[model samples]
Target: MTTGSQRTRTVLHLPCLGPDAVPLERAVAAVLGYARGRRWLRFRSPGRPEGRWVRVPAFGWARFDAHPPSTGPDADVLIAEGLHGRLDRTGWHAVHDALVGLAPVVEAVGARAAGRPFWELPADEFSVLDEPGTVGALLRHLGQEAGPHPAHVLAALHHRHPDLVPHLTPTTRRALLPHVEEGDSGVEAVVHRELRANAGAFAELEAAVAAVVGDARPGRLRLHDVLLWLTTTLRLAHAVELGEHVAG
Candidate 1:
């Protein structure tokens, strides 16, 4: 991990992909199992936006249909690690902003996709994230909402960039809002605080994941695996706090 002005950046040393590695499904199940005896987390869904919230106890299951970073274990591992690398240095709020900013476009693309998978879109389409106009567009979308919850956009970004695991979503707010309601710091502030304090443990976990998954450096997948792991860890931790039972 490399520390910068605001936060630490992670350089993932993923394990090599090979037949000897634990099967992808098994690895996914292990992560999801951590959610056992935990509460279900809710988030706004890109597919159903009519004031509907999706439940995610674990990303492995689909209440309706699957989302991105598909079952291709190689792709999943790659994307997860790529996201991990990004989150290592990015302040939680910056990540929140980027996701929120990108929500409108993700929704727009999904609408046009009409239930198509995100990977179906040509690579050229994803270039929109780098475009300057997107920022202006997001502002316009948020302006029309009542008592706008700006952080919700961060949740919506998951539709396409599943690699960018959500942090400021409605689900996370369940855990963080009490603090804010009590005139305390927001969720990201607290999580980042805890994460920084226990950086060594997280580092060890990262290495463990690499060993379990494959120790090769992340490639096109980037830090998706890391983000997935982080998101799961947050969910499980909050669930325990709520004393929610794991799904049967």
Candidate 2:
């Protein structure tokens, strides 16, 4: 790995498509397995605003998702896996803020995609770990002695299962590409321009709605606004909010 600023790390998605595409459950299972049974790795997915907070024995993780390169231990090396139609930067940022582990920056990386690749909307900056396979490298980075994490095992199993592989399409491919390259190409530039234009339209609509509510709905409108921002962040490719439909 070419050394950059060790203090300031950037997060990138793992590019391995994986056999049949492994489900995140399997992948997380692999992470647990690697703990060498030393600590208890619990994935706490509460059905409330608090969401899930995964704890591995001595490793205590807070339940907030923050932006990439988290400055505090609250969010150390984060691994953002799998994104759907929207990136949900807002939710991911929340996740990053909540993350607290051994690493410094809390971010996530994965190739969990549906219909097409989820590339365009990534953390601040990204690159596809295409060469030696992202999972293997991650193991090495975490220390080869520990072995595979339960998450890794689960992911591999999920890959073998045909039900997990998400289909691909031009849109997904386009969405994911911006995240892997070192720099934005001409195509990416055009897409950014169009997305900016759309942002203005969305902003106008939001203003109109706020005006209509006019304190009548109060928290309802505010809550909708929050959701809208989260939705916007998702669209921007910060984090994948899979919990809206899937409870755990």
Highest TM-score scorer: 1
**lDDT by residue for model 2 over 88-115, one digit each (tens)?**
5664443333332312210222332222
TM-score of the candidate numbered 1?
A: 0.30
C-alpha root-mean-square deviation, candidate 2? 19.6
For 30-92, candidate 1 gives per-residue lDDT tens digits of 433432223355555666555454444443222111324434323332233333322333343
The runs of at least 3 residues in candidate 1 whose Cα sits more than 4 Å from the true structure, single-residue gaps closed, are 1-58, 61-166, 180-185, 215-248
- Candidate 1 has an lDDT of 0.34
Off by over 4 Å in 2: 1-69, 72-79, 82-171, 175-184, 205-248
Model 2 residue 113 CA deviation in Å: 30
State residue 146's C-alpha deviation in candidate 2, in Å: 25
lDDT of each: 0.34, 0.27
lDDT for position 40 in model 2: 35
